[model samples]
Target: MASPIKLHQLRAFVEVTRQGSIRAAARLLSLSQPALTKAIKELEEGLGARLFIRHRQGVQLTECGEAFFRHASLILEELRAAQEDIQQRLGNIGGRVSIGVGASVARTIMPEVITRFHRAYPHVKVRVLEGQLVSMIPELRQGELDFTINTYYHASFDNELLYEKLMEKEYRVVGRCGHPCAGARTLQELMQCDWTLPTPRGSYYKQLVDLFVSLGVMPTVSVTCETFMSSTSLLAKSDFLSILPRDVIEDPILGQQLMAFDLDLPLPRATFYLIQRKETALTPMSAHLANLFRQHCRASA
Candidate 1:
């Protein structure tokens, strides 16, 4: 029978893979290089695969190493989370909670939410990666992100992930203050105007597509930018117009510089949702933060 893989072996294997050198990993783990090598060898023996190829320079992960790294990393992370969860449940707070945030949430709700979260749990680390919800899915699947508070998509509700609707967001096609197309009442009139829109894929992009399908004409695609902050900057400096959250104009600095066109057309509202892995229950600290987000979303609506 294959020998059982030990936690120490996994630690040594993963650390060596991360550092790319048995010597470097041993130093970090406070073990001798020979000991680290023995651990890696034992792990390979247990798994019946050569996980690493050692050379004079360092070491390289075999295909098995690459696959096993994902599993091992998740194991260590879950153990860490379990310990943190117990401590937090016992009224001790000092663990990290990572969440993926969309541009709209990052702008409006997050400021107050983060302020309150920090005040309540000063020692706990907060990782907020701001981007498109679609881009954060892989991280969410891998447990790198505890959860994501972002736009909901019908296709995204799968066997591996669950969604809870937070609130719907109204979007507007905005431009710089007093632009030439400011009086336009329809998307068709803005066909000649330079526009920066979301990239041509995923949920946000699909909504933009559906909006323009009936118009029989499309806005001039000057840029395909996803990050709203950069798109807003492009809009403010140039004649580029973009579909932005209605609350974006409420930004103190951006408000004075940008104006939303009051188009006669009804724009789409992006509904925000809390997304998490279906099988993995969140750590207590993460769950507390997630609840805080939901409460704030309800209050705003």
Candidate 2:
């Protein structure tokens, strides 16, 4: 039988894993090196595994340690969240909620959502992480982000995430007001024009590329921009085209310079969701933010 793990052992394990050295972890934890080492030793013994292996530089997590670290770190975060939740219930509302937002929701609803959130939780800090869903998954699994409000593409689903579908957003081939392909109605016609595709290699970009390849299209992808803002700017000034949800082209500010052109071809439709780790129950602060996002998406739809 394995020894029962204690909170002290977990804290010690997580810190040591983070600091990459026992001495540094001990300093951060305000404990002596021997105590930290003993805690780590006991943690490894309890789990019946060698958590770390030492080399000339420092300690590195073994394969087992790496797996344990994921759960251990999240356990610590959950405990912190629980303590904060109780404090907030007792009228102390002063914790941060970190979240990820894709362009679909952020472009139209973010300002209003933030305004509403600030009015209710004036003391709580809100951290908004911007990127495509593919880029933010690791953080979600690691509990760095409380949750995400974003659109889902074909490859965006993960076994570790619980996805609550919000709404389906039809996509269109978007272009500048005077784009040569502005009146284009076919994929082949749009393929002749330059495009500003997503820069992220693994997620949306790869999937888009895959779609293009499957359809016998090698779009004249002239430029690749990472953020929607940059790509929107690039699209507004040039003849470059991109596939965007209708709301982006219909955005009050962006609409001045952009318009969506229909195609006989069917574009990939986007479905937005409230995405979170399967085991993570969002703290009240974050849950409220997620609710605000859902409300906004519904109202807009």
Return the clash pairs for model 2, or none. Answer: none
Tens digits of per-residue lDDT for model 1 on 226-251? 78778888989999988888887878
In model 1, which regions exceed 4 Å deviation? Answer: 18-34, 53-61
- Model 2: residues >4 Å from true position, as ranges? 19-42, 45-48, 55-59, 153-159, 199-222, 264-268
Q: Spell out the clash pairs found in candidate 1.
A: none
lDDT of 1: 0.86
lDDT string for model 2 (1-301, tens) is 8889999999999998899999889999999999999999988889999999988677999999999999998888888888878887788888889998877667767889999999998999989988888789878877888888776555545778888987777777888897776677778877778888776444445656777889888887788777888989888888888877887788788889999897787777666788898977788888888898889778877
Q: Output the TM-score of candidate 2.
A: 0.81
- After best superposition, candidate 1 residue 162: deviation in angstroms? 1.0
